[model samples]
Target chain A: MARKALIENDALIDRLSATFREVGYEGASLALLSEATGLKKASLYHRFPGGKEQMGLEVLQEAGRWLGNHVLKPLAGEGTPRERIAAMTSELDSFYQGGRQACLLNLLSSPIGEESPFKATIRQMFEAFVEALASVIAEAGCTPAVARDRAEHGVALIQGSLVLARGLGTTKPFRKTLDVLADELLADLEARA
Target chain B: MARKALIENDALIDRLSATFREVGYEGASLALLSEATGLKKASLYHRFPGGKEQMGLEVLQEAGRWLGNHVLKPLAGEGTPRERIAAMTSELDSFYQGGRQACLLNLLSSPIGEESPFKATIRQMFEAFVEALASVIAEAGCTPAVARDRAEHGVALIQGSLVLARGLGTTKPFRKTLDVLADELLADLEARA
Candidate 1:
């Protein structure tokens, strides 16, 4: 799977992200990483001097930042809360390839994900995701507790659908879940209005 | 990690299950499988002629049947739908260890899981799970379509909560998702009654 094209740093991170998202932390051996990114083992070691541990941390950080910029920030942006939610869903949809893919966070958090030294980083990614969703709901005028609960619930559904959709061999479950999520997101704001 | 105790066939499967649940398909090398199952690589090959592929298919089937008997059969068993859903939830909670553990299907279906020959087996597992839940819901008096939708939604929430709960390092979200699922499962029946 190695490409002959010149690979930039960001491209390397993206390649690493794709590999990690598919095979997970422990499964992403140097051989697979080399194949995925078209980098030699020495090249990877040079790029990530700390080796797999550093590579994992960097990839997790990169995915987290991508979500923050592409998904969360838009939800917490200044448009109407409903509009913001819509934008956020689109961001998530694109990031996940409309449920055709697993979340990098979930992929990374597999058994190796749990055992990795980067566990805290994974936890932080989820907390930030939850917080971002909560902020939007709170702005929509629900009590803080209610808003937080909704955010947690929404995240859980989205995560579960990926498992189900993939398990069931259909994206319909995921697409339907998104529709339900859209409805759930605006329920409070519409109620208050 | 090979244990010295006499390992029953079921015990060996459980050990293999735990390893698969932890390291995933590609990550679970013969050496690791040997360590997990207390079998020499030659012994494992003798037991499973198809090697890792056979081992994976066997493990996935074992897990699927466990879910059918413990989770779905109870849900579709003789009882009120509420009672049935309750039974299913209890089985799921025990299986997941209150969100402290990840699902084997989820663990397996990482990139390698999809690429593995067991993909259809995984799909069948979900289809059966969905059907089992839908039967209980429909018997409670909803139309088949509505019951199916509710079952799908309920499964998605439960599945999503596992991801969220594991990611956030807490079981509260998973526990709460169960509550919501209970409500959703009976909502139509309760409304009609």
Candidate 2:
């Protein structure tokens, strides 16, 4: 009989996810995971029976779920498109900690993760996020192609600004880009209509 | 007597840099470094006497030099501003491998590297790149303030597009962003003049 997960709760996943996001997957060893979660190695193993790989997969899924709930879903939520976009941007600002946070997707989507079992999940989240944003843009006025392109562009802007914020050690670039891009997308649409 | 340095060759540094870029600092353990560079642990320690931390600092410096020499220097080279910007953009495209390759700076600027002794070097590289880019834009016709803002914006665009390209599992977004941003920054100046 297989042992079941009793303690791989949301809090456990959050703790592990922070470790993975702060370092990359390869860096988060069993010892480090234990240190991070205040759990013994055996306890962590009991929670994540498959070890580091399983922990990574669960963390990746959690990140995707968070994005779905906080960003993608909000973008697709009902409101004036402008209001929806504004709310989504606010979620992004908070999610990224005003650009001081490193993006887990960027961290996990690298060559180190080329063979990760969860790699496809990262790509799917990105596509879904883009699709949600593009839906709002297309509904506003842009052709489907243009809206899709803009949505992808917006994703890059968010991820890259996080990189810049971390690099330049300033929240200004990330904050400004978010506000600027949001206005360009929503305000421009309002003007066009 | 302290042993004089005999190893720590540039080629070894290059190999380690690639590993770091792929998996990030915390991910590139001494064992992994040995695997990536085909060097024995003793040999790597002999080369980098201070161990992984020493190797990391050297790699960070090398990345800065490469950016300065290739990207920033080209942007400030002698030519019409438009010509100079075009050449720099081409260099950026190649350096990033059509956005397929991960950025070493982004890899190092993560939370994992927050305590890295070389963090300031990363900031310096970004500032230098922005200054080089701003100089060209200012020469083209924009006010100094406008040029600087645009240069920062361009940097964010480049970095963000890389994140997007990697996430979307395609180069089209990266390439399109490069072309579109380049046109906005460069070609428009000529049209206005």
Q: What overall lDDT goes with each candidate model?
A: 0.81, 0.80
Docking class of 2: medium
Tens-digit lDDT string for candidate 2 (A51-102): 9989988898988888889988888788877788888889888877787777
The numbered model that scores best in lDDT is 1
Q: Where does candidate 2 stray beyond 4 Å?
A: A1-8, A186-188, B1-10, B186-192
True contacts kept of each: 0.73, 0.70
What is the clash count for each candidate, in the order shown? 3, 0
Clashing pairs in 1: A156-B160, A160-B159, A160-B160
- What TM-score would each prediction reach against the true structure? 0.90, 0.88
Taking all chains together, the TM-score of candidate 2 against the true structure is 0.88
Best by TM-score: 1
Candidate 1 per-residue C-alpha lDDT over A7-62 given as tens digits, one digit per residue, 9 for 90 to 100? 88899999998888776777788999999999899989978999998998898888
lDDT of 1 at A63: 86
